[model samples]
Target chain A: MLSKKQARAFFLGGTLVTFLIFIGLTIYSFSKGNDQSNHENITESVVRGKKIWESNNCMGCHTLLGEGAYYAPELTKVIDRLNMKYNGQGEEVIKSILMSPVPWQPNGRKMVAYEMTEQEAEDVVEFFRWIGEIDLNGFDRIVSPLAKEDNNN
Target chain B: MKYKSQKVAYWFFALSMLLLVLQLVYGFVMGFARIGFDNLHEFVPFNTARAVHTNLLVVWLLSGFMGAAYYIIPEEAQRELVNVKLAYVQLISLAVVGVVAVVGFHFNYWEGRKFLEIPRPLDFLVVINVLLFLGLILVTLFKGKRRTTTALVLSMGLLFAALLYLPGMLPFDSQVMDSFFRWWVVHLWVEGVWELIMGGILSFLLIKLTGVDREVIEKWLYVIVGLTFLSGVLGTGHHYYYIGVNKIWLIVGGIFSALEPLAFLAMALFAVNMYRKGEKKHPNKLALYWTLGAAIVSFVGAGLLGFAHTLPQTNLYTHGTLVTAMHAHLAFWGAYGMIVLAIISYSLPNMTGRKLYLTPRGRAAFWLSNIGMIGMTVAFGVAGVAQVYLERKFGMDFMLVQKEISIHFVVLIICASVFTTGIIMYIIEFYKHGRPTDEAMEVSIQ
Candidate 1:
């Protein structure tokens, strides 16, 4: 084993290298994604819809991007579920549900009745659709040795 | 308590205990509501109760850390606190701001962010309060005769924790950007800077209780701190995995966060090794237990359980499930929570000149709380695995899955009661220690 002084040097050097790599990767990742693209693919509604999502504090219950409270369903794939539930009238179904005054779950934890206009409902749906389009690379792929160990544990 | 100024730590600890009780009360309120006891639904919703429960937890822990600093820094530096009056001012203002912020949550006068829910105006007040605390701490350390590694590391942790809060305070239009920085505050605090504070406090306690050489113990502190930064700084990306951020976080966050446990494992090994190496057994065995407990349990909770979900594969299924809660409860309780209690156990006897450390109540408090928390972890774990299967994999209705998991909350409530009872007994032992006095300062712990 090296001396304690050597260990100190190695530790410091290792930390600096890892920290720099983390920053470089993060910046590069953000730079690649067109987070703000006003094109035919992504409309202004997506941006407006994101603002609506934040203002409503929907994340307090529903998780978007696999973050936030675990109390409600994950919203990343909400459009898929709503579409199936509505028998192909997904947007209309979402808009109507937002208009409903009744709490989603009456007996258990209740959703607060936020007054969202029709346009807000449409924009929020558009926002959900936009997030859905963003490819989380190989979303459900299992490619790590950790996964095997995780399962065994 | 070798100085009169050390007595000021008593009030801060007292505040911590009070807020902790409030936090538990809100926990019960939410727990009850979760079981269809929706009487408080109109007034204290789950979201509100959650906000109250979690915010109170952070505040109380900070209060405990501040108290630990006040009590430890003076002795480490071989000097009294520089401004006892200002310290008191800091404590009172902190409590007031905390109270006002929690009260405002009921009126919806807060942001929608999970942990950073405190409104913008109150955030400024928090900044001022922390500045006052750091000023008192730094001035005293600078003016003293000694500047040990433990003291410097603890102060540095506190300093960085303060600076890191600024990024969260900035207004961001993008949810992705807002979340990006929120983790800087939340993730970095627990996994990064707070670990430093935890390390510093652990080293101090180990040195005091184990009667080890300061040099030997402080050397371990350097390694742990280095490992924490090496892993934790990049581990912040773990939360970025699916937050509409860079895909690069998937690789960087997964790889680094998996290594995050090394720091915690090092901490556990360090504490246990120090204990074995010690010849002079300090009388405060309860303190030793808590200190050692914090180290080992944090490894299992934060290191092992955190690794279980840190990877992109497992998290895709378990993210934001009760699985996350399973890891959260244990990690928080084991790492920061137990360390605070450890310092309190060590300081209480000296603070009041009472040898209440070895009481039957104290023993009960330790065993029951640990076992009870473990039971809670298992309960959450079982429910979480089931949740990931039925809700995520099976693609069942969310509400149906919640209904299925309601049984676990019953188990959770029972264990939480046991956990709360142990805390009550510990607080009672704390009470029997009485107030810090001049006599307390006379007896030399070192």
Candidate 2:
């Protein structure tokens, strides 16, 4: 029979230990050597593109790194996936869609047309490229078939 | 009902109901959009609707929890709220901030970070609002004669929840880091401290409704919340695994997250055992239904369904797909949503001096909502599993796979309609209870 005091101790002690360990794990994961996030590769364009992505709430519809509403396509490897599909015109296609005045409706599912400038579109493309390069513990292959197909080839 | 100040909770509950209705509306907007009737695309895009839906859920649940705190604290502490007027001010400010952020979303005036979409400026307002809420709650609890474990646990949960929100506000140039910290707030709040709030409320309800010994119930409450943080703190790894983080998360998240269900399972068993062991069953059948339903359904939804997709193997396929949505819906509904409603159900009759728990409509609301939500879950699961197959497994085009799964949305809409009817009935019952009267404190004692 666990006493009330014992139960309280268990709760407090367990929480403290786990929280400390969680913090330690977080530090370990984010350490330079363990970093899979491509920290050094992040350029000014990638940062600006991320800003546009957030300001526009691209994640509301499209998923990045497999996190989002699942309403639109996953854009983690959009550059690679698109380049493979569009004969290396993937960046142009993306920019065109971003710069298009009208909504981009693929199979009647409408994406809010951002109607961005060429510069802004290029920034977004840079963001996508940066995102595509990061190692995602093999999830990029799961999301972009091109990655998997390339591997198979 | 024991104190006049407890009536402040009624207004907060009203706010919660209002926001919950708005959440459902946004949910329908997204659902209808899925089936290609995106007529509101120009004014309210899918992203806007999604941000609204999720943010509304967070607001409503927070409001509900605040209301529960307002009601429960005074009783547990043996005193009226220190300043009822200030509490009302807190409520109004909270509502204003929620409304402003919601309206801002329509105009692209949001930060667009999924759940934390409120713009940076509005995030400050939220912090102020929550700080005021916590101040009122903490001041009232400490000012009172007694500080029970239930009160301390509930307040601690509230305090930690506010602290966790700060992480989401941190600026990150890396999308990966942004998501990593975002889960620190979202995942930790939902899976970690929120369970403490749930446990606290469940402990309070069990003591009152079951006539269970307070010490016994409080002891188990500690154990339940203990299990929660033990597994849940480390379980944040699940979100980290594929989000450009190190591979350590894959192993850590897989093992710890698998242990997460034990907490929920323990909650279910505790609630059921408490009920069986209860010698004096209070007459609030409606509250009991919600309380027990919350426990059982959470085990199945949060525990079992969550387990279904939580593994690294399965999550590798189902991460961003409808499968996550499938688990998310039932989990939030069963765990957070139902507990809020349970607290409301239990507190309402006492506050209004209305013994309307015997009404058939209340029972209808319970069954219809549960059944409809279950149908919706099944619909999502089938579509999600199908999506994993056609899209992720078979490498079909995203749009093409979506077309194959669009039929599920139709089923979802039907179930949603059923679910809406139940909620409407529940709200109507809520409305029928009328306002909380100070005199009911005396009336309910009889």
Candidate 3:
């Protein structure tokens, strides 16, 4: 049985730990900087793809990492998946896949058409290609998608 | 007259349980689809199952809460319900609306949002039903002997629930604006107003079971209510970060939503501390289990995970994944489900005038449910982390990766099966043996 004073002390201790964790996370994220250039050197195509992504409100339909509308698939790893599926001819093949309105039938799940313009498809392909190069190992386990899959399996 | 309110409450409780069982079955089917996906051409597809699960959850919660409010309000106010017949009418209307919403989803007439997918007409009926329920509660308090803090807080919860839905129904030009107020309905109700209801019900149960000092319990209620509004209204900013809102939402949501957990943590501490200090002891062990379980689970689920996703940076990676589901599952069950259980455990004996304690089977069911919940939370939490990695770091095909990674869903389904088994055992126990006797008349004297 915890006394009132002991409970208060425990609470205060928890508050202190929580504050330290918060401060550490904030500082780490700030040090990492919000710039996209640190992980993947930004090319014109990548920048163009980002612009297209914003204009088309791709985030409204699909998530990149985990942040966006849950209506569509996450595009963060689209480049890699396409690369693996097409056997290493990376960007061009990914672009073709995005541009070609093939009726995607994966395990009988009918894929809906995204109706992207040729340029827009290229831009999305470029954006995904950029994400494929980033090193995301240091992020928190809860937010780190890779960490979750490895542990659960 | 007293028996009339009790009977009405019991009947509604039964109906709510029936819905709950249906919800669980649909939820299991949905979980299985996530894992197997062998037959997408089935009558109940994944989308249909998801809609049913979400809608059934909302209906059952409303029904259970209505029953709780109806039963407790009158007793706390020291008189019969002001309009008992209206209470029955409200329940019937709500049932009709619930059936329509669920069946509509089956026929593919859903609005496409997870919990808020009920058609517009059904949503309107639900709102009206809630308002009528609130009005009845208020009138009962007015006409009765006096007011208790529990009754007042519960009434306030009902009022806020109705008030929050209005903004959601308003016609907004921008989809962002529409989503903004939609959170007012969804987030505010679950994280905000629901806490108020939980606090009230928990306090009432504690007082009745343990004979704790009303003043102490009421003071805790006041603190919980204050923390709820203070944190909840501002905490709505958490949902705004990615919804095309201004950048300031990042700072506001991260900071304030972090504070929301403190309220629940404090409530947990308060309850446990009160139990330790109280002079009287509860006769029924299961009732005690509920009170403590509610506090502990709420602390872990609503408080801890809630804090994890509160920050904008974290939300940037954890949004819409299984992590959110983990938090919601535990929080809803801890805050609302446990409160309903506590109320039922307290009242069933009184209503039936029997000394009801959980049999050995009932005790096993309780443990199974707790274990299953923990398993589900852990599995989903890990799965969510995996999703962030594959999608964020590896740049994998989202759909293909999800297919590869749905093993976690299998674990969740297994856990749900374990939980269902527990529920079955509990039902059997309830039918075979009734309540404990000594405490049956404790509430009737008032």
lDDT winner among the candidates?
A: 2
Tens digits of lDDT, candidate 1, A1-153: 444566567657876897688667656755744442112355788778876776556666677767777776677656766666767687787787677777666345687665578998899888877766554454322222222244468
Local accuracy of candidate 2 as per-residue lDDT tens digits, B260-286: 999999999999999999998688999
Clashes of each: 0, 0, 18
Off by over 4 Å in 3: A1-72, A75-104, A107-153, B1-4, B38-40, B430-446
Query: How well is each residue in B1-446 modelled by candidate 1, as lDDT tens digits?
Result: 37889889989999999999999999888777767786876787777778888899999999999999999899899999999999999999999999998998777667778788888899999999999999999999999999998998899999999999998998765566777889989998999999999999999999999889988888888889889999999988788776666666788789889999999999999999999999878999999999999999999999999998889888877877889989999999999999999999998888888887688999999999998899999989999999988877776777788889989989999999999999999889888888888887788475
What tens-digit string does per-residue lDDT give for candidate 3 at B237-296? 788665444455577667779889988988899888888888786677787788778988
TM-score against truth, every candidate: 0.93, 0.99, 0.77
The candidate that achieves the highest DockQ relative to the unseen native structure: 2
Candidate 2, pairs of clashing residues: none
Q: Calculate DockQ per candidate and list them.
A: 0.31, 0.92, 0.08
What value does the interface RMSD of model 2 take? Answer: 0.6
Q: How much is the lDDT of residue B194 in candidate 3?
A: 83
> How many residue pairs of model 3 clash at the backbone?
18
True contacts kept of each: 0.36, 0.90, 0.06
Top candidate by TM-score: 2
